[model samples]
Target: EQKAVLVTGCSSGIGLRLAVLLAQDAKKRYHVTATMRDLRKKDKLEQAAGDALNKTLSIQRLDVCSDESVAECLNNMKDRRVDVLVNNAGVGQIGPIESLSMQDMQKVFETNFFGAVRMIKAVLPDMKKRKSGHIVTMSSVMGLQGIVFNDVYAASKFAMEGFCESLAVQLLKFNVNVSLIEPGPVNTEFEMKLMEEVGKSQFPGADAETVRYFKEVYLPASHEIFTTLGQSPDTVAKATMQVIGMRLPRLRYQTNALYTPLVALKYADESGSLSVRTFYNLLFNFGPLFHLSMNLIKCITCNCFRRGAVSPS
Candidate 1:
């Protein structure tokens, strides 16, 4: 029986591309199960594979948000063992913390963090029972360094990185390998979806403070950075496939263009060459300074107002 690799979020983006590439390789390397949140999206997944490659790919429904859904999906595959599970289903919510409620943060985690966790739990039993399997997580550079207006999304990715790190250690004894792919912004529907969701939260009023804030603070940079810094999602998908085939895969892999720069920055700080970190520090310092200046002004105003009319001694 050919080894089976299950990839989540195959409806589009890196997951979909990864599924197709894995299925199309002439070796018929593995049976690719391309699972999406909805079967309707499977048509596109299948289309990505085309008639010839589609034979190697199987589309399935996998709602990572629901435990029952995850369990049912796994149970249905009981006849075929899953040799590798790619936790790629995720959502990105970007907006001001003040505007987005706690529910908004929770929603991000449900799909990006806990959703991966749920899938891991569902597949681990089998992976452990077999004492052989690989678990791959899709993380982001934001997981390494947080950025503005992406606090919730960054937090979820951070959680994934940390979980995968710990899991890598724990799973080694079971002969199961765990790996994390931290990519920078990728050109995909994923980016558009994030922008759309964030844009939607701006309330009805055209001139409302929330809308104005998003326009002034978030939109400009996300637009510039995403377009300028982003790379094709296939870059990440190919990296994932490479990692999966490694007999002794590294604990973590960084495939984005920024990966090397970030690593250099990380070690530069440790080695006392502070150039890059200093640059970033200077870039981010304005936010704190601006907040401090605001508080200082408020204090001065309150003090002036509280000064009762001077008594004419």
Candidate 2:
């Protein structure tokens, strides 16, 4: 029996790629319902899906923020049964907290945290009845370790992490597996757009020195880290596939190994000061040295992958 996979936010980036990948599976193991907020923005997904469209894959209209939209999309399905639900819909936010409005912060949680919960709630009852299902969420390393300037965004993911962790224990008895795909920096248009927007945004309440640090120091360092350590959306999609294929999916899976050490810093010292000081030094005290080290690691890792000596994941 083929699994019915419903993926949200399939217009572009990791969501679109994952939808196409699963739909194009040679074994025909999955029937993908690739959904987006607006069908008008589906040209990219259609082009990528090509022959898979209307065959192994179908596009549906789904706005995660709306209960009516989510319910309607699922109801449209033949059996309204979602064997695998991929909650890939999300939004990103950056810059200082003072500059961020309450509305803007609410929007982030609406899509990133509440949206996932909405979908899970809709499908979980059916999954519970069937005694089986898989729920996969697109989380970030920020969920485990918050970064400066990404306070709200990190909080949203942290909320997701906690929500899923608590829910997973109860779902285990019902044979419904819940997994979080935590990736480091992913090179996608969503990321590039955020970078461009942040450059133009004004931090009204922040001091001049803080604003300068954000623009001059933080932005450049962040760009370098993304350039040197970022994973392609396809890389993340592959990790999602791995999670889906597993007989018993783990609660958390980090997509990028390069970020393992950074996440470890948080656990290594419960004092919390270790991760904070490490990031401070890397961004301020040893900026140049940190950049050099990152570049060296990127070179070596790329070479190793090219030689087939290491897995990109």
Candidate 3:
């Protein structure tokens, strides 16, 4: 019996790739419902899905922020059966918190945090009743380790981390699995757009020095980080597929191997000085090595957080 997999935000990026990859599964183990907020934006996904369209894969309209839309989409599914729910729909907030609007920040949380919760709530009962299901969410490296100028976006993901971590425990009794896929600097159009906005944003409420630090110091480092460590959407999709294929998927799976040591900073010290100080130093210290920052980042993280040999798997 092919598993019924439903993925949201499938119009582009990792979501699009994941839906198409599952539909094209050689074993024919999945029937996929790919969804987006608007059908008008679906041409890209349709083109990508190719042979799988309307055969193993179907597209539908779903607004994760709207309860009614979530209900209607699931209701329309055959047997209302979804064996795996991939909550990949999210919006990002950038710039300093002081410069960003209250409205924009709320919008980020609504879509990134509450929006995902809405989908989970919509599907959980059915999953619990069946005693077989997987809930996969798209998280970020920021969700595990905070980044400067990405405060609100990181907070929203942090909310997801906490919410799912707590919920996963209860869902275990019902045989439901909750998995978080944390990727660092994914090479997606979404990120490209964010970088463009960062370059052009006026950052009205922030002082000139703060804006300078943001645009001068952080932006270059960000570009270097992306150039060095970014994972393509297809790679991210493959990692997600691997998790789904696992007989017992882990609660947290990070897709970027390069980010593992950096993330380890959080656990390396009880006082939190190691992680914070290391990042603070890196933020200002590596201007000359900006083009080859992978070396700099690796050196710092490895020195601070390396404890044991990482498994090849």
Candidate 4:
């Protein structure tokens, strides 16, 4: 029997690409259910799915934030047999914490943290009863290491990383698997939407100098890093496909090679200050040098990155 894979947040970006890729698999290995909060936004996925629609691929309405929606969607599935569950639904927030409202922080958790928990809760019981399943979550590099100005988002992912790490241990006994895909910088609508929102965001409690630094210094540096180093959503999707294919998928997988060194900084030192200082210098002390280094790295590894994305296995 073909594996039943349910991917959330499939209206766009990594979710959409992964759903289509799995559905269009040459070997007919998977039957994919691509879900999103709003079915009306599914035109892009429908267009991309092409002939696979209602055959290998099906679209469903699922809001990860709502327990009723999640339960209802799973109930509607044939036997609710989710061999694999990909938690891709998430929201992003960027700005100073002092300026951000408590509601803003809660909103990010609502979609990024609690959302994944809701999906896992809705599916894990049946997975355990069957004695097999894969829980794949779309995490971020920030989950491993925090970035300046992305405090709340990083915290949310960190919570997820910890949650998954703890859960994986127990799930091992049941022959179930858990994996976290930690992509560095992916060029997706998620990034674009956050960037646009940041432009209009008001820093209520933050001082003018701090606000100016964020807008002038941080945003430009961030833009350069993303432009020079960001991978496409398809790259992320390909990585996800590879993880799904593994007999025993890794607990944590980072999608970008260029970012491997950055994440390694956390483990390379026992003091923890090494990672903190490195990021501080990159943001404040070596802005120009940092951009130059990223460009050079991109030039040197562009071909390798492209090849990995094309043939993820």
lDDT of 3 by residue, 9-91 (tens): 99889999999999999999999999999999999999998999999999999999999999899988999899999999987
- List runs of model 2 lying over 4 Å from the truth: 296-313
- Badly placed stretches (over 4 Å) of model 1 are 52-54, 78-80, 203-214, 263-267, 270-313
Q: Pick by TM-score: which candidate is best?
A: 4
lDDT of 1 by residue, 1-313 (tens): 5678989999889999899988887777788888988787676776778964547787778889998787777777746578999999888877667777788789889999999999888889888989999998998877876665678998999999888988888899999999888777789998788767766665433346656656764576456555555668887788888887778887777775433453345555665456444434433444345444334434554454323111111
Top-scoring candidate (lDDT): 4
Once fitted onto the true fold, the runs of candidate 4 whose alpha carbons sit more than 4 angstroms away are 296-313
**What lDDT score belongs to each candidate, Candidate 1 first?**
0.75, 0.90, 0.87, 0.91
TM-score of each predicted structure versus truth: 0.81, 0.95, 0.94, 0.95
Q: For model 1, what is the C-alpha lDDT against the true structure?
A: 0.75
Superposition error at 159 for model 1 (Å)? 0.8
lDDT of 2 by residue, 22-84 (tens): 999889999999999999999999999999999999999999999999999999997999999
Candidate 2, lDDT over the whole model:
0.90
lDDT of 1 at 137: 90
Worst 10 residues of 1 by lDDT: 304-313
Better candidate number, 1 or 2, judged by lDDT: 2
